[model samples]
Target chain A: MHSLKDRTAIIGVGATPQGKLPGSTQLSLAVDAFKAALDDSGLEKDDIDGLLTFPGTTAPEGPLNYLRVGEALGIDPAFTGSMAMGGGTAGALVQMAAMAVESGHATAVACVFGDAAKTGGSRFNRASGWGDSWGIWGMMGAAANSAVAASRHMALYGTTSEQLAEVAVACRRHASMNPNAVMRDPITIADHQASRFIVEPLHLLDCCLISDGGVCIIVTSAERAKDAKQPRVLISGMGQAYTTRTLEREDWWYVPHQKEALDRAYAMAGLGPQHIDVAQLYDNFTISVLLWLEHAGFCKPGESGPFVEGGRIQLGGELPVNTAGGNLSESYMEGWLHIVEGVRQLRGQGGERQVQGAETCLVTGRGMTLNCSNAMVLTKGEA
Target chain B: MSDHPKPLPEISDETRPFWDGTRNQQLVMQQCARCRHIRYPISRVCPECLEVGHEWVPLSGRGEVYSAIVFHQVYDKAFADDVPYNVSLVQLDEGPRMFSNVVGVPPSQVRVGDRVRVVFDPVTEEVTLPRFTPEDS
Candidate 1:
């Protein structure tokens, strides 16, 4: 694959405070993040010519015009597109931004997603309810789905419930350092075990916290980034994969990968797992982190338990994942905050438990009972 | 037994043997003629090789529980009566993995790599889901 490396860079990244927004509408939050992104890019809205976003997002077309961000933002882009529904759109969209720049189709592109799921029952309430026979057969919620998978992984690999607890514990430790995080109080394995089982093998604490928030990114030609003021993070590698939404997965241990966005992105950028120094993962549930870790080849399949034990994924561990606390401790939306955390790591702006000497970061967006998936690699300043 | 729940999608001329074998209490798999690769979802072509010619094969109904979860919580309020049920992917003796309920068991009895065999439970006249049970069954 012809490398798109250094062809395009994320010049600006922005997000609304992630945790809660009882009064704010979803569109308002998205517009806020869009304006913040424009301000941070030091680019007028008119300079933006291409707009890349999720088709189902709250703001869609209105917010871009509401912010009046295009004037010198070079707003007239040669391309505009939106991803299909879900968090996987975020990282996959970045690759779209790179393709636009590399093909000389557009110089500047924007990607964003925001929602007020807390206002309703959230996407889980939505993804369920299909009235398909799954309901008749007793396959109801994601927690139930994961509890079984988690238990199976444990039963096979000797992955203790305690090891899974460490995943929750380590995330809270990181969240405590991040004021933007929703649940910052550090948790213990005792808490994870003691907590009531929402589904067998998965405690209540193992689930994600829902909140209202917005996230956005500004993509531009890498050449222009040399003259741009803020530090630039190149789009190194990315990948995505999709499976049948309603069908039971063939292997809870091995996710289908032929179309994984991570594979495509990694091949596009020619970088592999070993080069990533920092990672921001979508931990909507504890198993989200574990399975994706094994699926991404960060560890052997079914080994996510030990892969996470002993403070390994903490600030000083082998690979620092979900340093912003993740949906497990942070906000749950499209997992856009994972991108924001990646940007922070690249800019050396992540405070407290920041991954020291972090130059390259990887972020994976997850969704819907292991359905939607994607990954992106961001490298510090012109790598 | 009391009236069982409505069954999943029924096999037609295209999917006949798939649903029928389960009704007769037999385990079956499909192999692509062009590439001889096995596949589920009962499509005309092999997902791996895209070869259209294929045949149905039967097996000992033996396989390992590659991965699974039992739901104490009902996925839907409609399934509330069926609480604490198991849903899982069983990697069959053939290469393809099949999605079915692991029955004749409880939470304690289920584990990955456990030995299991197929059994049929009539959900309706037209449909019978292939469930797994312990080897002793």
Candidate 2:
């Protein structure tokens, strides 16, 4: 398998203030985050020769497309493209950027993702027209789709609502420490249980926050990263896989593609789950993290319920999963924040939630209904 | 009753047969004539053999509930009155899976591995939805 290990580095990360930005458009939020990322990297707009973005409101059709974003940032890039792998695009973006730079296509790449879901309303709600004829019209929301997977997990593995609630509580606890977190008020397992059910087996608390926010990261060759303003984090490994059948498979709850992606990523990084100092697994829904934990080999299948019990995923615990609050409690940048948090931890910039001597961190992105998945391993680069 | 305000599927040349079969109260899938593979959502070419020749074959419509969920939140006002309806992924004994609502039983009672059979629900005059109910029902 081809490897991009240590060939590229993430030198900067940025985010717009998270949560209900009443009047902000996705483009404004994206531009704000993009400028900040450039500043954080100590690179001018001219230095960025590549651009990467996600589809939908931010795609080329929308105002935040690569051409528009480049125009706003005064950049003429050698490579510009959009990836539409849903939430998994962020991790995939880093890999794309690394490959582009490694092959001399471009030197610097900026990957940005943002949305104004709260202020602009959810495009997902209106854009699901195709689902109508597909027989999933009324049942295609992320929460509803994931609920099916969660319900199956409960029936097959005896995973309980209580175990799922633990994920929400742990993410909330981490969010309370991060100033930019949207749902900062700490929540308890009791609180999670008390929350109303959106879909059976998935309480309202188990769902991720749909807020208005943007996140961006700057990727460049390791040599160019030497002069970066902040501590550089090497993009040591990355991999992506997709389940073509999606929820149509008989064993939909078991996400085989996630394991495949993780295995390839681990092989590329030359490390295993045991060597990961911290984890920023995607938590679009609480059950997502549970599935990821098991599939990523943190624990045996059917044992994640017990493994995550008693705050084991909290900041000071065994793995410290989602130390920057994750999509559940932190701002939901559609998995973009997970990569940022991973970079922060590797850079030793995680202030209050910093893991003592964190070196290598694992970050993952689980896209629409568990169809697309991507994983990346990042480590602190030599200063 | 008012129609479901949720967005409906736009019937196209590729998807027309599938929708037409549902309207006739039958579950149909595109079976690749070349590779003999069954496909869903009605595609133009066979994913397996990349062959365009296919036949719309009626399925048994008998399957087990692979997974299920009850929607408590009203994502659209069309579904407001139907708060707390169960949606399930039925893995057809014929080998293709479909997303449909499971009725004829309490939403909370639906469980994985429950035997189910497809039933058609005529919503709009032009659209008939394929739903599922407990096999025993």
Candidate 3:
């Protein structure tokens, strides 16, 4: 048996009301969400013996670290650390928490994330210099990186702007059904096209919201999960892959590593794309979802543009993606919310946006110059 | 001294020679002595063969636009006047890619697969930013 398959389960998932919550510090939001997860799991604060965090990129004070967040939460965890893989951190942290519990390092591990990019006056604009000479050319922000990839996808595969619009429209339509979603007013393909371009091939609508939010998921052994308040969402499979080289590589934009990650995850779960009832793909940009759809083996390479058309990926479609509106519509917790939404869907708690009879879900994340990618397979606990 | 408002590349010991090549109106990169692999954004060890010994070799200064994106919003005030400017990735002839602007045309005119050649802009006394122009331009 795969070491990670069904060894640990997510007992609780909590997300504070997302969007411009003024005066909410990262630490405070993290604590609030942590407490909420504790309440949701019917577990006391004393039950958490491990804490894992993914530091936010745009904290008002400083990027979140485990020591500061752990101290504020008043938990002296036996296993505690933070991972920085950009959007990949949340899924990776959950996997870390699962491994920690499966190895008996801790009874329960809480992976928490909080960001104040919206309230803290972050525009998500900064130059990236990983020993590269990109800043001099005015390449700034995460959007530009993905925009270049979108442009390449369009060039290599004949992907059209209208096809990209379908992603924005679907996410907006799903967001309209989610009351907690920040941008709930429905938008159309025309709206996406009419919106001003942040980067060519990507519009304002295609990019994700910059909002303040916090999310927490508590992981414990499958034995403990059986006694939890909420139904258990088992972590069946987890895989992560990364690109070592960026601009120098010939196929940097193609992101071939993402498929490798998902393949590993699927192999561990003994499942494939045909089994995923819902997906909470990281939507840092609409193109990201398209890439993930292809990478996760839903369709062939360059077929994502067409696969997303005709409402195939929206709620009630063949594979419902971003059931909680994703980062595009749901408040951007930097892929942390994807895990929350995946857990919620598997738990059958997606009040309005539930995928009917959802038994399995695929949650994916990619970040940091579009190099790191991760995928997780979550399934409903046996009845 | 140049009064360039935009962020400039930080020169390091590993990248000094490449910048020096740019200052001399040439596009040069480290070619691994053992593997003959040319590397960009300058590295001490060759990524392919882990070769420490290398020679700075001049490139053909020709390539095609692999991909490009035009920035419509001014994320930084330094680039405020350059809104809608293009930041393109050019795949050079010798098999290295670079982040450079395809100049001598409208940002919208830059397209993938467009043939381009390098041009040096002496942004400062110490730095010369390498940009590209359509070969036929």
- Top model number, TM-score: 3
Candidate 2: CAPRI quality band: medium
> For the second chain of model 1, what is the TM-score against the true structure's chain B?
0.87
Backbone clashes, each candidate: 33, 0, 0
Interface root-mean-square deviation (Å) of every model: 3.9, 2.4, 1.2
Q: What is candidate 1's CA lDDT for residue B72?
A: 59
lDDT (tens digit, per residue) of candidate 3 on A26-133: 888888889888899999999999999877865443444788889888899999988888788898899889989988899999999888879888777877647654
How would you class the docking of model 3? medium
What's the lDDT for residue A150 in model 1? 79
lDDT of 1 by residue, A62-164 (tens): 4353233333233455677555636566777777787887888878777766666676335463223232234434555667556656766777678877888
What lDDT tens digits, residue by residue, belong to model 2 across residues B1-137?
34656556677788888889999989999999999989765677887788999999999889999888888887777778887888887889988877788899998899899999999988778778888999989
Q: How would the candidate models be sorted by TM-score, starting from the highest?
A: 3, 2, 1
lDDT of 1 by residue, B1-137 (tens): 22444336645687788778878888676878878777675776777777888888887788888666766554345455665667766777766666567888885567778778888888778877777887777
Evaluate residue A39 in candidate 3 and report its C-alpha lDDT on the 0 to 100 scale: 93
What's the TM-score of every candidate structure? 0.84, 0.94, 0.97
Off by over 4 Å in 2: A55-60, A126-137, B3-25
Kindly report which residue pairs in candidate 2 clash with one another. none
Instruction: Give the higher-DockQ candidate: 1 or 3.
Output: 3
